[model samples]
Target: MIRGMRGAITIEKDEPQIIWDETVKLVQAIVAENNVQPDDIASIIISTTPDITSAFPARSVRMLEGWEYVPVMCMHEMNVADALPLCVRVMIHVETTLSQRDITHVYLNDAVKLRPDLITKNV
Candidate 1:
């Protein structure tokens, strides 16, 4: 079955290095929490808040060894009023046997406030 895992992380600033580092950290946590292997990933979609224009989050994913074959895309998140700033969010689709209820969603740093219910149960 194809499953989707969601994750998000907040960066302290809009610098390229900080964006790259935070993106990698967020993806790493998602992979670890979901036991996701590169081969099993179908595609990864990343979005950042409008303030995060220093770098593309997908660039960080491609930097990971063995992730070259994985499909990844990055875009700007909708600039909604009161939305979290410097936030990067990702949705990873993968082929897995885990049921929806068993799948884990990760929200780290200040992004954890985005899903308090899930944090208490899954993160």
Candidate 2:
């Protein structure tokens, strides 16, 4: 069976290292919370806001976790009015035995504001 975990986080700053660190931390939490293994991950699609084109967030994550074999792609989010800036989002598809409700989606730091209801639901 297949399951998915979605996570979003905002960079504390526009710097590459800050984005890298935060994304790494958020991905780690998703893996831990959902008990996701590297092999279980089928693919991960990451998107970042337009204001953040300094680097592809997925590259940092891949390097940080040594996910040389995992498939990851990065893209730019659609430009919309009054949208959040300096944000990175991820959708991870994984092979899992758990039910849909068993999966946990995470939104951390300033990103929590994007889905306050989701955070509350998970909590």
Candidate 3:
């Protein structure tokens, strides 16, 4: 089955290094939590808040070893009043036997506030 794993992380500033570092951190966490390999990932869609224009998260993801062939895209999240800024979010489509309820969705740093209800009971 193809499952979508969601994750998000917040950066302290809109710097290229910070964006890349945090994006890598978020992806690593997602991969570790789910035991997914590069070949298992179908595609990754990354979105950053409008305030974050310093870098493209896709650049960071594609640079990961063995992820060069994985399809990935990056875009800016819709800007909403009072919405979280400096945030990077991702939806990774992967081939997995794990049920939807068992899939872990990671939210790190201040982004954890974005999904307070995503805690998986099976973990």
* TM values, all candidates: 0.96, 0.91, 0.96
Model 1 accuracy (lDDT, Cα): 0.91
Q: In model 3, which regions exceed 4 Å deviation?
A: 120-123
Q: Rate the local accuracy (lDDT) of all candidates.
A: 0.91, 0.84, 0.93
Winner on TM-score between 2 and 3 is: 3
Give one digit per residue, the lDDT tens place, for model 3 in 3-120: 9999999999999999999999999889899999999999999999999998898999999999999999999999899999899999999999999988899998888889889955
- Please list all clashing residue pairs in model 3, or write none if there are none: none
- In candidate 2, stretches whose alpha carbon ends up further than 4 angstroms from where it belongs are 120-123
Instruction: Please write out the lDDT profile of model 2 over residues 61-93, one tens digit for every residue.
Output: 689555878899999999999898889999999
- Each prediction's RMSD over C-alphas, in Å, is 1.2, 1.8, 1.9
- If both were scored by TM-score, which would come out higher, candidate 1 or candidate 2? 1
Question: How high is the lDDT of residue 69 in model 3?
Answer: 100
lDDT of 3: 0.93
Q: Decide which is better by lDDT, 2 or 3.
A: 3
Model 3 TM-score, 2 decimals: 0.96
User: Top lDDT: which candidate number?
Assistant: 3
Q: Specify the poorest-scoring 10-residue window by lDDT in model 2.
A: 114-123
